[model samples]
Target chain A: MRKIFVCLLVFAVVLSSVALAASSIEVWQIHSPIPEIMNAFDWAAQEFEAETGIKVNMVRIPTEDLHTKLVVSISAGQYPDLLIWNIRPGLEFQGLGVVEEVSSVIDEVGRDNFPTATLTMFQAPLGKQWEIPLFARLAGYHYWKDWLLDAGLDPNPTVLDDGSMVVNAYNTWDDVLETSKKLTKDLSGDGTIDQYGAGFQYNRKGFGDSAAYAFSVITTFGGHLFDSQTGEVVINSPQTVAAYQFMKDIYKSGVMPPGVVAWDGYDNNKYFMDRTVGFIVNSNSVISNVRENDPELADKIGVTIAPAHPETGLRTYSGSPDTMTIFKTDNTDSAKEFAKFLLKANTQVEMFKIMGVGYYGPLLLNVMADPFFSEIGEQERMFVENNKYFVGPEYPGVPSPELITVALAVYNGFVYDDALTRISVDDWSPEDAVKEIEKRVLEMLEER
Target chain B: MENHGGPRLTMMQKETRLGALLLMPAIIVMLIVIAYPFIYSIIISFLRWHAVYPDHPWVGFTNYIKVITDSRFPITLRNTAIYALVGTAGKMIIGMILALILNKQFWGRGVVRGLFILPWIIPMVSAATTWRWMFAEDGVVNFLLQRLNIISQPIIFLGDKQWALAAVLVVGIWKGYPLFMTMILAGLQNIPGELYEAAEVDGANGLQKFFYITIPSLRYVLITAIILSVIWTFNAFNVVWLMTKGGPSNSTHILNTLAYEYGFVGMRYDYAAALAVMTLAILAVFLYFFAKLQKVEE
Candidate 1:
């Protein structure tokens, strides 16, 4: 009897050990194509596992498949314990109520750790934090300094300490157009124009870059797709028409490459990197690519805030930051712990150092003061200074759950891009395109 | 009745029982994989099922009505029809010509046949990506056309609304003709050279022999090929989705890509489901008529 008791007791301990071993949490993150960025996440996961006895299983999903995968997983009642994605879709997930309210996580991480502007973008429906801001992705104009110098344009335009470019002929939209014409040339004298002055994707099928740039143009022109206070569909204003006209003018000016209407998210980067185009509105991915692959070209590349409105001198920079959220799972506590771990200043600094400053800007304010950021490059300074101008898709509107629906319309090629394509490719008048945009926005709003 | 442990069964009954037992696993799998999803999709089509929203209130027929009334629906449907019909027709014509040529005695016929199947053998995504580059404004297509003086200026093949669908169709035909060619070639081999020789002895010309004996012998094969090609071209999502993504003002959108846009991008699962059901219905009607025609032909 004593032998039997001993064996049962031993079995109980073994079973408990097995149970403890199984207490790992799963996290689904959109896979970055860059190896170092992915390795940084793996390192963080390993560190988290080392710190806590609980293991972290990091599942990397491609960006295109992530959204549908999340929806299917959640609907099938097999969602991960944690998810990291863009703040817009993160808010949409929160609005769906599958995510845990991470206000407590933010409190635990310390609300003051993150920048207020960046943090505010994630706090949908107000007074509640749905996700923790991971990193900021800021958009700007990436131009070749050598090309500018060759064209007799300012290689280094005066930027205010506040991160806004001083409005001048060199920085305004019209001035940029004039500069583009000067830079647009046939260096080979092959009886064909081998280079374009400027280019940005107007393709409706692009992954939100087109919409982001178009929205920046619209916002700079003093227009709002939705009223900030009322959340009404207001994309039919004269300013929107002017913005559409400006985009059409750019496409029609022979400055952009032929078929700008069909370029995808990567086309601008390809064009800029291959020296086919002198200037483009894009995120820092271009810089990161050049810095890693073509250092010579990287030295010649100049990063600045996107062009200001030729008339109003208003410059709006579209920002889509990566964010982390804890889903409502049995492993909520472990997920929350991992989120806090990711939000740590040292962890972020280490990760960003490996990821390179060109890929992501710091989310935590304290991390910005780290030597890693300070010594990075001039472009890093531009990224940090331009953070003040970072605005979500809900730029004119207050960030809310409704903003997700509005932003989805923009992201899904239903609104801004559709309007741009109508005016540029389909030959619809800007006013008519804006009217159709208004109608579509209203329909989507109604459905939402 | 036998006095065994239980009531004894007759031979037919035993055979029937064994047959059912053998089929049980397959039936269960079919139920799980096929029937459940089909029924679930049909049910979801009747509801308002946005992936993000919590409430999926049943608005019977509203989703379908909305799908029909949506402005993009007509355009997508028209585009799908043109893509299916024109793409299949092009594939059949090209495949028939190639199969006929390769059927004749020629040096390196085997090598030529192998080369013709390369497009079909290559993965669709890789082919689509390569074709996208080749169709670029400054790509090889324009370069070649300009060199030949066929056109003075470069045509943005995949970017122009007027040419996007046609470009997609060209890729579809190129990728698909191999299957038809192989099928028709097999059918040609089975035609028994005696028929062609008899037609020739009867003072029939080459076209006459082809039209009378060859075509008549290949009717079933051609019909089967056409049906398969139509289904494939109609449901083709990857090529169009990867190439243009139904862009240049959604000119290249087929039903499949549009359904993807609605379901995945727009998050309107109900509308997407409705579009899917409607597509199935349209294909079902076409197949039903095709079946009737096949019966009449028989």
Candidate 2:
């Protein structure tokens, strides 16, 4: 009896030892303070752990504070096992060698699975193996199609039609101005305007949403900041001169609100949902939010293609890719394996569809092209299929994104100068704006 | 030998042991808290490191050189100087005047004293945010100014390059003056009434008493306050960063903001460490000169 008991105990000890031998994946994700997504992240980690017998940990920080926190912590030798950070910072992190390379995992994960929406980031700058893309974030207008018919610019053509609205696809700066002129009207027939055509922002800077969106309109007019490959800038080009000129013209034409320059999405969204503005240009996630926050507007709202390039039929919107980096390490084995798991087309589909409203588009081309993307409903398929190209602002003479950050800053700084604010719709020249942008950017670029 | 000194003291003289014993806990705490972080920061500054990264690289003085040559370097240094000089001087002047006023017995004296410290009591980031709201184009301050017919148009205080630094400096003075007032009040309370009594007995006037007695007596406190204020203001990034982010075209960026940007925003730890190292070097020189000056006062 004693011998049998001892054998059973010994067997139990061996079993426990084997269980302890398997490792846990200690991952740290930079968290935004959204409750729904936080819950989703927790659930996903649990499921991943249950499936693999690996422990998954997530450390989150506030979105506003993550940039500085990651920098200081990483600098101080306190980097987490794994973290999700903005892609721009990923570049700097790469330079510091704090991230592990996971090229094999990317190769194995089947790059073909990631959506076309996020391919640019997965490629990484200069084609270096550092991080896999975790999410793709983009923004645009969630408009009121019914209102467009009422405003008299719908595809069905809201001509001589009262109590209905439609808006034109913003083509030339002149076309947008003319549409806005018609859109900004006093329905009550009072002296004051009851509605406005467009909205803009002079405040709320972070990740450059306000400025970048506004600048995209400038870009749609054929304005550019830098050369893509040369790492040189032509910021002071003629294209940019026209962009600002259009802004001034719109203001003078009394289409957008006089206070539009000081208003961020907070004010703009309010004006939009209040049915006081013809359109609002902001994040894609805003479509879901409008429905949730103001269902009335949701019923009235419809998504549309971003403004097209004046000459080319090319449509453009800012693409910000969120990456999942295997931080730099000498041990390529586990890191590569982990990255491969994340890169799978199945995983990309899971990332988009499983998460809340699919704010993150898949990095795999197949997933982006797939109908089952997390947040994209059948209603938004046209936008997804036809208009999901990723493009960052170009630096004029230098073809580098790094230089573009500087040029954008300079242009935004002088955008509202009262002295030279002579903007006109037809004069929305990308060449002129680029020339003005170059003078300021070259000094910043040449600084060090 | 005298009988009192007959027994040779053990453990490095009896009186010195008492003093060492009294200070032992304090010294130990300082070693654990101050000395350790200083050493850790020094070691970290040498290595190219990130906490989340699987590996941290080692880069030497390259970070230091990079910070100096950065375009924002001189601008940051210059901005820091402006904030320190103007902010500290403004606090000193306001504090000195307020301390003199409060020195006299008055109605609601205690209430007035506490009220003056309201700015200091509020959390810095919260205070800065409130200031941002106040300085906003359509905020209460502009409304009030417009009502008073002070200006025809609202000024974009935080959005303009030329005005951002001046506005940040003003906010610093408002947030920091209460602390200065408290210190000056303490200094004022310490001055003996007998000195004023004696001065009055000798037919010395109010200005004479102030220049001869009050000025000399508080000189040490004034120097200490100035030194401390300069250091505090120079290292300050919370208020200015929260308020303007050295923006309106990098107009308000100071040394600490640069350190944060390079380290965190730029994600260049080596560069950040270099900026921090330069900050330390500058502070060390200031401390050395200050110590020398303080020794003369003693």
Candidate 3:
């Protein structure tokens, strides 16, 4: 009996030492609707573990619930070691002082590898980098090519030298309105309109597709929610009112679906996919989804930059970059190592190839030269070219911590969406809606 | 009764000690889980607390003041009152009617009762999602209405601001009536048949019997059900949130959803806490009357 007890003790000691030698890091990633993208993360984790002997535990939270879950987890002192999120929440997390600065990781990964615009956007207010930039999503208008052709319009437009598309028939807001009128048809001759010409999400749910589209329109119309230079509340400007008026005109003109006012972020994508609408402004996720699920529909889709304001001659597109941040935790070193691994050019290219071209734009300039990008389809090429005009959430204003805070305030409060809702649904004058929005934005900024 | 001891403990004292020992764990759990958070939320309500910021300075009643004076406050308050009152009334009426019908000697009564209880049995998220889809422009609801020749154009039930709240109320009433139905059904069963027979002997009609005998016997159950229904309806966030998200022009925002917007989206924890405390206070006043009603019944 004594001999058996001693042998068991030795075995226990060996097992304890082995357990102590092992290291694992937990990653809380926003859940991707696409299975390939999700599986890519798992594949990367397995590869990392094989190379480094450090296990990666990935927890997927739905995109809508990520922020709330993170906040609650942070308060409970149970946050993950690394958090992967889109661009907007990173600054808010940094401001909350829950993220660790990762400048060293970026340096180790080679700073020159990433695009200057993508790199600098994450480095805000304080010159410290809080997140490692991964992939970017550039927003543009996606249209049904066949529908455009059926309306006697040019199905294939010319791409300018500056990366802007020139579809003369729908190149400007007024042109879009007229083209939409032509595209809104009763296909079955049942007196009930079957296809809406335009699709825009006007719901005030949160910072979603609606807010992004509204911001693009506001910026294109030469309006800034805040003064670009001084960061003062300027939402009540004539330009802002004009943007709201245009949205209201589109809604009232019977071009957009009547239910557009209540749509969530993904509704427009569904409408576009189902061919219920002729055109929609969205990220490439819609096309990616189509390519995966409905390849026939994917072939007929066309992509271009959003319409330019005829008078201002300005067109703005929004860019949301996927980023990873290390939380202030005991496993910061392991998390940083994993983040650096994701930044490696080969790893990024592999993930991008798996997700497809237009779904995610390259963060690293070197990845742009890869054969995958060269052999991409026409729509994918246009999506990549449109990145030249892609701007951050603080479009008119510079990307600073102060301005990002105000932008987040406007976004989180759904100011633009509310203003649009007032004009379109409640029948408030654009000026009145803008003024109410200005008041709300000012209050939010004051709270900040 | 041992002579060696200076004094002997009483049996009552020993039982009391045992009872206290048994109750200690539950008391500690309540203190930790319920009391702590409740008090913490009340404390935060008096401070300027943004979740993203580090410093939380005390601002006294300023947060409460802002909540009251904010432009959206009145709108949210009115929406909440409408949702709570109308929702409760609708549920109670529907529940009472269903219970009255099911109480009679009817055909396939068990199956009918089971079918009526489905809205309650179905998960709230699933029910809300189904209802939202049903209320969509091109959904079955519109198709049915259009096919029945009720209207030429399909009603954008969840999209139009004018109809959004009504649509939400319809779902709320549908999901909630079962609880009251079950409670009132149980109450009806418990009542002695002698009272109804006595009413019949006195030549009291059906409506008279219902009002004079049935209502009074089920008075306590009805009051309890109303209180519970009102509280549940007022605090309902899932149906409204999942269906409309307090939207189509912020036309459907109740206090709970607005507080969620302030707390989670806006990161204005102080404003959210104040809104929560105010909701608690309003419910407390309602519960006070309910307690009084219970006492009178007792």
TM-score of each: 0.94, 0.73, 0.93
Pick the winner on lDDT between candidates 1 and 2: 1
**Residue A103 deviation, candidate 2, in Å?**
4.4
lDDT of 1 by residue, A1-448 (tens): 9999999999999998766645799998877756788888888999998998779999999766787787788778889998887745567777667788888888888888777776777777776777788887655677888888887667875766664553232477788788889988988997788899898887775666787778878888888877787666677889989988888888888998877887777788888999999878766778777878878879888877667787776877776678887888778888888888998889998888677776678878788778887687777666655666666777765535676566665655457877878877888888998898888777787787
lDDT for residue B2 in candidate 1, whole number 0-100:
54
Q: Model 2, B1-298: lDDT tens per residue?
A: 5687567888768889899999999999999998987777777687765333445566676557667777778888999988889999999999889889988999999999888889889998789878876876667877798889897677667765667788898899998887778888899899999999999999999999999999888887888888889889878989887876666456788888877766554444556667777788888898899899889868
Candidate 3 or 1, higher DockQ: 1
The alpha-carbon deviation from the true structure for residue B225 of candidate 2, after best TM-score superposition, in angstroms, is 1.8
Better of 1 and 2 by TM-score: 1
Q: What TM-score would you give candidate 2 relative to the actual structure? A: 0.73
CAPRI-style quality class for the chain A–B interface of candidate 3:
medium
| CAPRI accuracy category, model 2 | incorrect
**Candidate 2 chain A, run of 10 with poorest lDDT:** A417-426
Candidate order by TM-score, decreasing, is 1, 3, 2
Fraction of native Cα contacts reproduced by each candidate: 0.75, 0.10, 0.79
List per-model TM-scores for chain B: 0.95, 0.86, 0.94
* Candidate with best DockQ: 1
Off by over 4 Å in 1: A1-22, A157-170, B1-8, B105-108
Positional deviation of B60 in candidate 1, in angstroms? 1.7
Worst 10 residues of 3 chain A by lDDT: A391-400
lDDT of 2: 0.63
